[model samples]
Target: MTAMALTQRPASVLSRLLHRHEACRGWLLLAPALCLMLVAILFPLGSTLVMSTWSLDGYSVDRTPTLGNYSAMLGQPMFGALIGRSLVVATIATVVTVALCYPMAYFVAFHVHRHKALWLILLTLPFWTSYLLRVFAWKVVLGYEGVLNTALIGLGIVQEPLAALLYSQTAVTLVLAHSWAAFAILPIYVSLEKIDRSYIEAAADLGDGLTRRFWRITFPLSLPGVVAAFFMMFVPTVGDYITPAMVGGPDGMMVGNLIQAMFGPMNNWPAGAALSVVMMLTIGLAGLAFLAVGRLVGR
Candidate 1:
């Protein structure tokens, strides 16, 4: 070959090699996260599906795959009631938390200026303690001889300790709200923080009142974070067993409590697995519905 042609061929090969190297690097960077997710999430989900098809007692796994467990779950009258109760509790808790947090988030984002960081730290400070301990603390406070009852009696607000204070749906809802309040606040605060000050100022200059400016510009823009927080709080609350078990009475027992009982006291792993699978499907559908609503509202 001619020397010039040979040199040009070498340069072309080197350029192609460098391009492939960059592409390989990008794939290598993504591989670890993909692998982690497959192992952590997808693998467990697949295993749950497989386990749901068989009977697993504490003694041994029955290799005979059957739909009997699912059928039993569906046929049980309590299953529908349990699911309905769970949805109601989670929905109410999510709504209450959002309502309470939005104003607080708005205050912290727009009203607080000098010590905003300190206030945020204070807001999140309660979560630094163990969650179980916090729940236990609430139990003490709401119990018959606890702080709230004592205060009410001492203040003459009530003649006697309110027997309905603990072990009721109301108690469960209150605790859920307390447990998940920070989850709601941070997201709404982030959304409010991202709003451009100029937009509000311009709206005011256009003779828009506070209500008009907020409705027209602020609320619409902050919606993504609100939607995100709603799901973040709702999904976990739906599956939460602790708060309900701790405070929720017989009437307040959620679907998660039943699932736990199937796994633990009942020794019915297959049933529990089926319940988990069903719950996952339910949550996935709910998420899609939420996203659709969010998009509709945003548009």
Candidate 2:
């Protein structure tokens, strides 16, 4: 093309793009992301919903859409109990993880200022390894013939191995808390670190005691991070079956194990899909309700 024509074409393209409505421009920019989300998230979710309605008939999956799966899943008291148990364990993990994480984050943010980078590296070093490996490490440490039992036995603290340490609800909670500690700590640390020192100093200057300042200013500001940490720890722990399966014994198993069993040799795909969809919807609604309550309380 001629030089003048080429320049004119470029200017025309730029001018047209620049002159577009802001909302239209924004949508155009977001189109690629919307397409990706449609394929990756919505498509699979749609498939799952469709499959949830399919009933098994002898050999083939009956394509007829029916609420049979939902009826079957909801009718069982066992499923309700398992779901409640999962929530309880997840709640315990969230609370314990946050409780332990906040103090550590506070210490790191306030006390270890000099080697902060080194401390952060050491803090996250455990995550470089496989998540299961860490859970397994805990299993070894808590086993009947493992470190805790052997140490207690050597120290004459207990007469026999502490069988209670390895395969119970306690073990599940302990392992989950430990496993997700880093997720809790990092968000809290970031929030604590971001608290402008000036606020604390100003509070102190105004005769506010440390306790008063913390309750009035620090805790409120850090709550976003705390909530983030709680959800991060809570959501996955609800669906976690690996830690329970490896260390839980029969009593410690979560709802995820039952879902897996349904999908596996049980050949109950419709029921499994229904259970998963219902659980997801329940969790989502609960999260939304929580956010609504938090917003109302804040006002």
Candidate 3:
């Protein structure tokens, strides 16, 4: 009897609390996640903001609050060019990766009724091998006397290996696209898979062709995944330092490489912080604009 009374008392208390504030339970449930984001994301961002305002004094950091770091970053023409280059490379990679992966994703989502889990495992298998190893393999393949050159020479397609394959902007873009393909494909596949088959069947019953049905039902429903994939691919690729450094030679240098230099031999943490802040803000604005445009188009 006493045990039953205790449980009932708690239930009554919870009911009263819930009745008093409809949103309180929801907010309570979300508090842990919000706290986690505050610790992991907001704290680092706040620290970076604080660091960016510090002045650079000779070889050491000046704790004095000043906007010199931002002023210095804006003063450099090369900085602007690097940022532009990063955007261009990241965009190209995003587009190409999505283009290549979408058909495969579509195939798996629609045609492959059996071994669906196997296909997904295979898709992600390449990543299980270290990312650095894949880049290095590409480097070897693109080298002047590497496997590609050897195969081409053996086939008599060309008298000499192409010197232009490695350490260029083209190489950088290709490597980035390859590296990030899985990220793009999985999201899109999930989106396509989530779509109700009834919608497609209904469209077909209404005398719609395959193309019409896809355009009307499947494509629109899959866009949320596409948008999510785009952000996932674009944001990280822009900041990728290792791939660009390993295969991207002199011409392939992006803003990430520059940021790395600023922190490394240059010993300009404040300037790096400033550059990072601007880059983050630019990416956030671009993402917002993309979503805005998507919403308008959807309407």
Candidate 4:
């Protein structure tokens, strides 16, 4: 009996070892991706934080760590205004894109059967072009002597070019909205496509009107897409520098512009790094808040 029990212990120990070996293999399979993320993302982020504590000029570095940069940024009245402008532009662009894309997505999803793929292709066609070129085209169109102003003048709508039309907050919002439209449309279309057709039919059969059916059946399910679209538009717009630089007036400059200045001509690398970190944190927090709100509203 003692000999038999000793032999059984070896078998049990081997079984446990095999189980742990399988688990280790699974972890090994995931190791490459985890390593890549750490190298590509985490390393840069940690380095940036370290850099943010030290000031650097063009040719030399100041090893002294100070909160003076942050203090100066907070002291500036323009800092608050720039942050406000960025938020306003991002929010407006997100709202407009989501509202406009929903109907277009709905049409492509439910209304149009023939050439649906063609229509979707066309919708995404603009993105194939260079973003900077597209922005330049908008700049030309909104310029004082541009097509829009010329057309309006020809129609006698106005005697002169509206200087306010270009290089204004409105121009920034419009261009960003146009640029981000595809971001808004695709997700909503995907969501609407995934919804079962029978559900809509059943709601109709129950005598729910078109508006009522849409509100009850369609809208709730599409919340995920709406949330996705909002983030897609909001995140990039908040950090956008090019659009504001080209089209935005001095008054319309965003926080990204300031960060760029700190890194570039301003020669304040530490401040720029700090600002970048803060912006990332702000965006992360905002995204989490939006997700929470979306879940609550969905319920």
Give per-model TM-scores.
0.89, 0.90, 0.90, 0.87
Report the lDDT tens digits of candidate 4 across residue range 1-299.
Answer: 99998777756665667577987667767999999999999999998887777776566778777666667668888766777778889899989989999999999999999999999999888798888988898999999999899999999999989898789988999999999899999999999999998999999999999999998999999898899999998999999998998899877789999999988998878888888877888788878988998888888
lDDT of each: 0.89, 0.87, 0.90, 0.88
lDDT of 2 by residue, 1-299 (tens): 69888767655665577577677688888999999999999998999999999999875689999999988876789888988888889888888989988998989987886989888887788788898999899989999899999999999999999999999999999999888889999999999999988998899999999899988788878888887887788888989989888889989988999889989978888888888898898677766776676566555
Candidate no. 1 TM-score? 0.89
Give the CA lDDT, 0 to 100, for residue 16 in model 3.
Answer: 80
lDDT of 3 at 254: 93
Tens-place lDDT per residue, model 3, 65-168, is 88887787778899889989999999999989988888889999999999999999998877987899999989999988888888999999999888888889
lDDT of 1 by residue, 1-299 (tens): 69888777656665667677997667767999989999999999998898899986568889688987789878888887888788888889999999999999999999999999999988888798888998899999999888999999999999999878889988888899889889999999999999999999999999999999999999998998899889989999988999989988777789999999988998888889998988888888878988898889888
Q: What lDDT is obtained when candidate 1 is compared to the true structure?
A: 0.89
Ranked by TM-score, top first? 2, 3, 1, 4
Better model by lDDT, 1 or 3?
3
True-vs-predicted CA distance for residue 137, candidate 3, Å: 1.7
Q: Kindly report which residue stretches of model 3 are placed more than 4 angstroms away from their true locations once superposed.
A: 1-35
Segments in model 2 whose C-alpha atoms lie over 4 Å from true places: 1-15, 18-33, 292-299
